[model samples]
Target: MTDLRVGIGSLKLKNPVMTASGTAGYGAELAEFFDPSLLGALVMKGISLEPWQGNPPPRITETPCGMINSIGLQNVGLEMFLREKLPFARQWDVPVIANILGTSADEYVRLAAELDGAGVEGIELNVSCPNIKKGGISFGRDMAVFARLVGAVRKTVKSAALIVKLTPDAPVAEFARAAEESGADAVSLINSIPAMAIDVNTRRPLVKNVIGGLSGPAVKPIAVRMVYQASRAVRVPVIGMGGITEGRDAVEFMLAGAHAVAVGTAIFSDPMAPLKILDGIRAYMENHGIKRVSAITGSVRT
Candidate 1:
């Protein structure tokens, strides 16, 4: 009975629950397990200007409460995504946010221009992927570069909402402020931390890439802090993600000033995690006599 609808700039979500990028490969793959309409939005995999083969084998490895991946923004190029994936995905009822990456500011601008006409709801600018050795995380590490990159993309995408996704490794408040100044409508945070694991018996790194991005329960606390700081730093909306597994976890992020929360690594553990979390949030609101989800946003105790 609680109103769960939330907004990210000009885009409105039915609820604050959305499938994170990379985890939900385009909405088509998860259609059988859950209805895409139930989600706030579906962010496609990180698409580039050209197709990428991604890193070599052993891209993913399991940790105690989290997982690491070096997927390297593997996906069909922007043209292919528009021609092959976007048409079909448009049939779904929920908003579709295209997640895109590029090697330079020009590439980001070009990709954003292309996606603006793709009939999707918005674009999530990927500035914090740790898998790629070059442009991914590097763009987010420096506030100046981050601002310039976002400003370039902002000039290109005339219609769609631009959401800049920031890295948790950086000073989130500073980065978020830069994103806002650069004309971002909203910002999502805490992609993943760079990490590596070793196989004791083989006495070698477990992953083929030797290093990867860590996601899941282990990163939740860091994410919350980043979101909280970011919320204060920017006047724009914030979408928080990192190791969110349950409705309570989602609530925590919202309390930390996230307008909406995204579920990433948790989907692998439970296929219906987002839906269940949505239900749990509604139930929590009802039990606590709270009339809406927005009322609880940023209400956490310091």
Candidate 2:
């Protein structure tokens, strides 16, 4: 058997494969396709301080080689997740990571502390939400704002390993280093690129939101470049994600210095995508005489 285990700060994974938040729903629905425990970790959908109904209809549209979605971070409030969602995930042996977003810094801190206290193995901050008090600037887009939030959340989250999901709107290296300095144990990158699709006939936007995050194979190279830049900038682990669809795609990220990789938009097309990608990775390892998965990280030749 291959030694696929890897560690992200204090969190350990049986393999380097995880479910990207938002794509995997919660743990329960995932079981219908494959065993949830088989994954390195289950990153549940993003949760907020309050229940958000999300955007209006026609919130998603397919683009060439990818898709754009303006789902608007809709999720069950933190209360229900604690009451019903977390318990079901705890049933599995795999680690559970919570993807959290909030309108204000205090809300982020509280969400981190609550989920950390509730025994989540990891907490991934989704900092793409606009900061209401900060004149609508995204927390991840402003250096000082991003650092302050991460630093504050770090103070309260004592148990769970902190992971910041970096927004592509900022300089990759600087933001990633800031997260590491602010006490983030790891960083994940290339959260869907901002994009739009237009219906030329009607002269209208395909998605009602006018613009949405573009995800899928279209963003892989950018993801790889960012991951490469980030991993070199910070000593902490870097989790690379963008347009990973096959085993080779995951392999590219791993080579680009991602300690682990997450499957996102690919899940919409193939429910078995993660497992299949894992199999592909295993085959690549065996063929290359690589005895351990960790050996693939950062071994890319210049």
TM-score of each: 0.96, 0.99
Pairs of residues at least 3 apart in sequence or in different chains that clash in candidate 2 = none
The number of clashing residue pairs in each candidate reads: 1, 0
lDDT of 2 by residue, 186-249 (tens): 9999898999999999999999999999999988888899999999999999999998999999
The C-alpha stretches of model 1 lying farther than 4 A from their native spots are: 129-137
Local error of candidate 2 at 77, Å?
0.6
lDDT of 2 at 81: 97
Best by lDDT: 2
